[model samples]
Target: MKKFDVLTPIGLVVGVVMLIFGIVTNGGITGFFSFIDPASLLIVLGGVIAGLLINFPVKDMKHIFTVIKQGFSQNEQNLDQLIKTFVTLSERARREGLLALEVEIEKVKDPFIRKGVLLAVDGIEPDMINDIMSAEITAMEERHRKGRNILEKAGEYAPAWGMIGTLIGLVLMLKNLNDPSSLGPNMAVALLTTLYGTLFANLVCLPLASKLALKTDQEVFLKQIIIEGVIGVQAGQNPKLLEEKLSAFLSSKERQKAAELITSGEALNDEA
Candidate 1:
């Protein structure tokens, strides 16, 4: 399941607030108007968009919004609950044989887990199952990399385009050096472009790319655990031993929690 990730939006809002506060503290509320340059924004944002269009195919670019949306949401995978589920499945398979798991597999919500369990029930060889699932993981990684690359490139281009805008502003300012009154406004344009570019890159693109990368790593890790559990169930491993095996994937704190659950007999009752 996926849920709204409040941290991303909250972080963005806090950053803007901090910038506004800094400006207000230094030069009053009127200072905020000095930083708002429509021309500078156009240069930075337009240049970034053009660069992305040139860098990626139209079809791929169409999914850019979807990719960004992912950073605002997070998969809710409870490792402890997942381990308990596999242990329960292992116990059932051992008691009644692999074919008996078909009904239980239907109740599983995760397509990855359902596919793995179905393959095991179909009597596929363990090696073949691992090979198939591992290939899918590799494909998923490739797709994620493509999506993340767009954001990364946007981050890279933002600063460069900002510098370009600054150069343009400098040329115009230098052309009318005799006009002392015009220098301040021109200099503001030059400096604001760089500021806009840096802010967009650091605050938005790069952070989102990092978030997507972290999410990808987490998903791959969970899938690996699923692969292990599915194979163990197929092999008819001892339920207690299988639980211990899956528990190895958990952190020290989570391992302790799982141990406590088992010690109190809550895990078995929950499975039952």
Candidate 2:
């Protein structure tokens, strides 16, 4: 459950099944015994932990953990709801005019929505407001990119750090070549680091970076709709036309609902 919800369950299940098949075909538990080396793991894990602490601030580390926690449980939003919200906001602005919306702007719950409503109500020139909003959105995306880049760098370093640990183990092993008893301990360290590096890179750091990149793209698209819809309303475009334009950000089913409302085939409570 921590790794995959119903949305992505099949792919995860298949990967696990195939991994087990590979392990079984290659002598199962007997082959697995060859990969167990504690010294290798210590170096790989120690390096990863140290690198993350040195590279990222405490606040950013907290945020990274939050992103990981949220990724597994985050709900999929319906695009239709977003379309409806824009259509409703646009229609209200058209009827009430800009000045009449000061209270609505003040009451909006989301910071992004509030900023857009405030700008639209202030009668700011639409193009100028759009330029400012777009620049802000671009900056936000850049931040997300930097965050993921940090994780990617960590993943790259982890494997290299593991090799470093392996080298140390090899040196110690070579020194004790005369003693058969010490040879096994040194060999364990050499192999363990490689295992630790591979597991940490594949299971943790790299996956987090990929997930954050995807989330950043989604947020950028959502913000674009707000910028376009608010500006269209401020310009006093036809309500039907505004609905059509905003609905473009939504899926087919969502657009159908907006169309129904425009055609007077559906009654919405928010429209006075």
Best by lDDT: 1
The global C-alpha lDDT for each of the candidates, from Candidate 1 onward, is 0.90, 0.70
Clashing pairs in 2: 40-192, 40-193
What candidate 2 gets wrong by more than 4 Å, as runs, is 1-36, 57-59, 73-75, 103-108, 251-254, 257-272
Residues 172-200 of candidate 2: C-alpha lDDT, one tens digit per residue: 99999999998878877876787678766
Lowest summed lDDT across 10 adjacent residues in model 1 is found at: 263-272
- Cα lDDT, model 2, residue 138: 90
What is the C-alpha lDDT profile of model 1 across 1-72, one tens digit per residue? 888999999999999999999998998879888999998999999999999999999888999999999999
Q: CA shift at 136, candidate 2, in angstroms?
A: 2.9
TM-score, every prediction: 0.95, 0.79
Clashes of 1: 0
- Runs of candidate 1 exceeding 4 Å displacement: 260-272
